[model samples]
Target: MDKKTILTMVLAGFLGLAQAQNNSTIAEHVKSATAISKVLGDGRKVATVILEYDAPISNRSLSPDSYEVEGKEVVGIYSNRTPETAANGTDGPYVVIEVKAEVDLDARPAPPTEAEMQEKKERDRMQGGPGLRAGWSTGGSDEYPGNAVVLQKKEIRTRTGKVYRADGNPIVTTVETCPVADRFTQEEFVSPYTGQTLPYNIFLPENYDPGKKYPLVLFIHDAGVASGPVKQPLYQGNGATSWAEPEAQARHECIVVAPEYPVITVDDNWNYSHHLDTTIALLKELQSRYSIDSKRIYTTGQSMGCMSSIVLMLKEPELFAGALLVAGKWKPELMGPLDRQNIWIISCEGDSSSNTLQGEAVAIWRQQGSDVSEATWEMTQTREELSEQADKMRAEGNHLLFTHLTGGNHRATWFVAYGIEGIQDWLFEQHR
Candidate 1:
């Protein structure tokens, strides 16, 4: 249950200019870039690197905030190594370092050069004429270079003036592509029952073969509010995209179906009676088309999606092996059927009183069960503690886990739950 730090997969030349330098003593321990996250509004990119070395690391030298990209000072550093104390060596031989920098703010596109403009003009002429390509281009323009946001390797320097260059090349591309084979794919799910076509994102195993059966994770996305439009799960929450991330896909290759529900509904209901039917129909259609392990199907979601997941758990418990419901209320009247399935409910302290009350309902329900262990999350458990609790729950043959996130934002409760180390693995292990 140790929460393995999730690293972003940076492709070759991930640090384009950074890798040009000769490898140094530090480069000997350099591993691939595990992950990168962008805060567009903040004009920064947080990149994580993994290093394995025999010698002890200099705390200040390895600190994430101590590194810089293109001379922009790193705003913060977080290392997932032993004792979080200053320069603690007990936690290492291997360390994961998160380097945060204003890479985007400094990499703003420069005005196009005359030569480039002429080249674009000529290319446009060949394609059909001046302004034609620009008109057709989705976001490209003659005013500036399109695709200018290249993820280059920036210079990495410590606070003490020491510099380090990557000895390794990028193993993945930062440019997001569609239908990336074995990765998240955007496609239409045609429901034969309603003759309705819904847009959805599915992640297939990298080594997918028709001959093999894989688990199916049906993620129902929260619908924001009753008045908003229905969006794809990935749009609903970034965490939903994690199912398709290289890290998650690598850990447990499965077929993840995130369907978009129509926005024309009352009270933002996602898992209501009629919608549940359509959702199931969608699932059936997906199953018929893909190599899905019928017994290993699972579902998880937040808010509206969580409600939907709960409804599905009740109406069609036979269809799912497990369910993780976050930031949603549970109806006691309908609790009768949930006992048959493996369920985990999570909420945050910042969540609405209704969410916390639901957790209490789950706790009360657990007391009536023959096999149940009740623990208050109080939003205070560390990641390690959460993992241990997850282990203990599975060990005790408990069917329900209600955890309260005491301090995080309620809107993001699901994100943190999804980030938990063994949660997804635990769900995947359940089979009817």
Candidate 2:
């Protein structure tokens, strides 16, 4: 072969090797596998196929408007309906793929240009909001070693509609439905007090009994998915998934209610207090509709939702038996009434933004004669360590329990906070 042809063949071989390695690494990160299935439209013809991967799929492997099934080009790709975190933490791998109408196989957009990359960096820095620091965006140039090509916030764009494959005949893959999603019933409540509507997801305990009163845990979503869509909280954060696990249900046997309100609660600052009144009304309605233990109602939230939970407690301390606030600060204005409620505060030492707030809350509770105790926790701690901490907190005879977790990132710390053993049991033990 000529010298130019020889060089071309060598480069192609190297690229193939690199791709194989990438796929291997991606597979290892997947705790469970992605479930892919065709979505048929009118006449039972293939319209789209849902791709549910346990980990984030690489943009290079599945780019918008570039996927294909049996040589039939995918017309578009959509992921807006996907939950922000899916089953994993925000930084963990959990992806949902949507394939739109079809186009010619040759119509895929070219690889992102240098100009496009630069533009996205600038936008993500300015408008990417809180979780941006988690390195969710694949940064640096493509030539940067180990820097995978992730779709930047600005690069993820697609339309939702029907488009046919070029050949009018598309092969499809099928899989079972997601069991996590199957158990939830999507619901919306209209508050008569404020006339405001709130969408929520409710998971009924498998052993639910109408005549018997069971404990209820009200979970609030953080800023990202809370406002734009109705069921965003069901996927964006760990609170929903944490409570949905069969282990949790079997242990607690309580009803779980996750409310999705309209408005970004936490961003540069936490502000769920913006719609506090409407939220209170929503809870009142839930209480009337279900057989809830009046003395065992509990509340918990992360970030923005945490801030709002504090406000909710301050205004209606008599309503909640206990609360666990994660990654949020304590507002001094509400300090006066906080001691009335049993509270567990969790924050990561690395999350400097919330450390000061947590400290202030802890001090105030102690000063007010509300029993208070402090402890350190790490995600790697064994079950024995977890139970020991729970025992110590209970012995302190304190109204407030403060835990500082190490070895966790600020954006994804909620997963670690909720995963600690005996923590939920502690919440369940409290009574008004």
Candidate 3:
């Protein structure tokens, strides 16, 4: 059977402050500013802005009213060179301004038109491309800024007690930093067993030291992005980026590996592919190359990727401490005692395909005394409610976690699932 790949929704933005020309003395000194973005549960937003000044500025003279930001609210202002707030004093060259940025990144892309599809098919035929024509991915949209952070100059007192008003438009010229995913570097992997090549994006923790060991997360993409591009796994959904986010890292401090399989790794019937073999090879190579905590290694994926992750765990159950399977399922008979291992199965309540298969598998696990913890959550619940339930389950000491989400569908289930910090926390806490 041909692998029926699942395509995913894509909602992808930046801020600017490059040149400020005004009559005020401070205007001449202000060349531009950099906007730092962060991926929150809602989407991507400008977390802070770094103003580059040619002279020293007093923190006491700077306030939230010192600048007018378009489409954003300035919460507090500081002249510290670093992103963090500092004591009120004279800090030189750079000023960090905190911005209130909470926006949603959940827009879904429209399906292709008939003409567009025909054009794409013709192009594929001309190029002799491989793989099913339906595969899609989110390559780098979430990591890079998609919208702008506009800053407007206002009157402010300099350190010398001199007042200045440039009253000029401050265009945000650069987006120099992104939290967590910023540390990810692009690399390639080639299988020594099958000689097949795969391109992937890898994230290492800050101040990585070989003297200490860090846990690792292996994120597999859904069929949606398997054939799209090299880094689609990172952009397709939060599956790859969630565990590496700053808050999650603060708790787990692990490495992340996201590969674009470029081919179907498994079919709906559990037919396997060579890419799975290469994935295992890549993981083994990474263990030898980095100080990865082997006992804490975990696998998580969506759809086709989810099934492949299960196959990986089955092929070498000893290599995985736990697994988070989202929006995907396999037959209970062919699952091979995996219910006895640490696994969490999550699916949207209304997704007939996923729910039917997952329910059957969970039933089998329960029959065998797998001691699973099952919960149904509303996708509209506030973070506090979700976290509260997650904390409760975390304390249950069960190896299997099955969550059925209401008010959500299959494709979008992952978007909300990855943003659930409570579930991420539980994943990190598991160990062999």
Candidate 4:
């Protein structure tokens, strides 16, 4: 036999010997698995799957192809010591599989047929809005509720170069992963005024110190997430989570609160429910519990939540220092002296009612002796561009800034609007 063939035979013999020595199958050694997911720019995505072994596992290289996650693209595979403090391991008990995740609300396969296009057109006409997307979509929510992962039985090698066939029975399994959204502790408040209960998700900054005061962000959800599962809004968009993100916290650490209402907060006729009042009540309760900077309290929301925010601003103008209202509109006549308040209203030019009505509110504010700075920005503008526009307005000493995003639509407006750091900074700077 040739030298190469002889080498191959010897290597196969070594592998067989290694396999015989390592009698524990992979499934037998697996203790547990945790699936890790995180919020992306527009929505949340599954990011990693980690499995724990029964004993300390020697560090070894494992190809990503050894694992399969349903509907996710595996990007990396490595050994881990723990889910948290999860640095790559030298001799750890965990195996990690990282994946490229897609958002659940926007995962539809495209190249829509003519029939689908016509249906989308008809739906747009019927709904009278863009970005409705022929379904109850809000450009928010996690892509994976529970993804099935498989550890395929295959030949793998140890760091010492010993090869073994990773035998396993029933490779399909579910990993229990913790999303950052789960960080928000679930709580409820009973309003004294309305005798109503408001369920909310509150995220206190890590290492929260009561001696040091922190600002609080009140996030109201759109009609899409107004119904319960209270965490819907927390995962739906960046409204609440953006404030609590590590990067944002590194600059300005604050608390985030999101209230989920069982009923719609507001309707087209400008009517509202008692839930808004209870939301404020919940805020007051939070203030009594935590050391909150009352002057810097901010309120923000989208669609129904935005409308509810307007109502709150009008109801107790003294309560909030500023408001970030997105993709929503109020009757110009119903709009109070919102001009006097530090308000930033964002809407896409493609959103007819929101654009027109929000424009009217701006015009009304301009009429009310308020210097409002208005900007019509392109949808393609970089974050720097948006920040620059916002900076110019803030520097100009404008209380109300009206930004009309060109060529986008209602549901997608908040996803883009909330990502601008300038807006978040401006909100933090406001005081009652």
Number of the predicted model whose lDDT against the real structure is largest: 4
Find the 10 residues in a row with the least total lDDT in model 3.
Answer: 1-10
58, model 3: CA deviation in Å? Answer: 6.7
Off by over 4 Å in 2: 1-176, 266-274, 382-388
- Candidate 1's residue-wise lDDT over 277-357, tens digit each? 677888887889889999989888776677778777777869999888877765654575576678887877777654656
Over the stretch 1-432, how does candidate 2's per-residue lDDT look in tens digits?
A: 122322233234334544444443222222222222211100011223333343344333334534444323344443322322122222212333333322121222236788856765785777554343221222222210111111222222112222212232221232222334335688987766666677788888766788989888888766544444454565444576566566677677788888876654444433343456767787788779988898998888887778778878877879899998988775654565787779988887877877777788677777777777788877456646876787778777776888887855454457556645468878888999
TM-scores for all candidates: the values are 0.59, 0.60, 0.74, 0.77
Candidate 3 wrongly placed segments (more than 4 Å): 1-28, 41-44, 56-100, 103-106, 110-170, 205-213, 223-237, 245-250, 263-273, 331-333, 350-352, 382-384, 419-425, 428-432
Model 1 reaches what TM-score against the true structure? 0.59
Q: Considering only N, C-alpha and C atoms within 3 Å, which residue pairs clash in candidate 4? A: 35-177, 104-143
lDDT of 4: 0.70
Query: Given candidate 2, what's the lDDT at residue 392?
Result: 78
Model 4 residue runs over 4 Å out of place are: 1-28, 54-61, 81-92, 102-148, 151-154, 160-179, 378-389
| C-alpha lDDT values of all predictions | 0.53, 0.57, 0.69, 0.70
- In order of lDDT, best first, we have 4, 3, 2, 1
Candidate 1 vs candidate 4, TM-score winner: 4
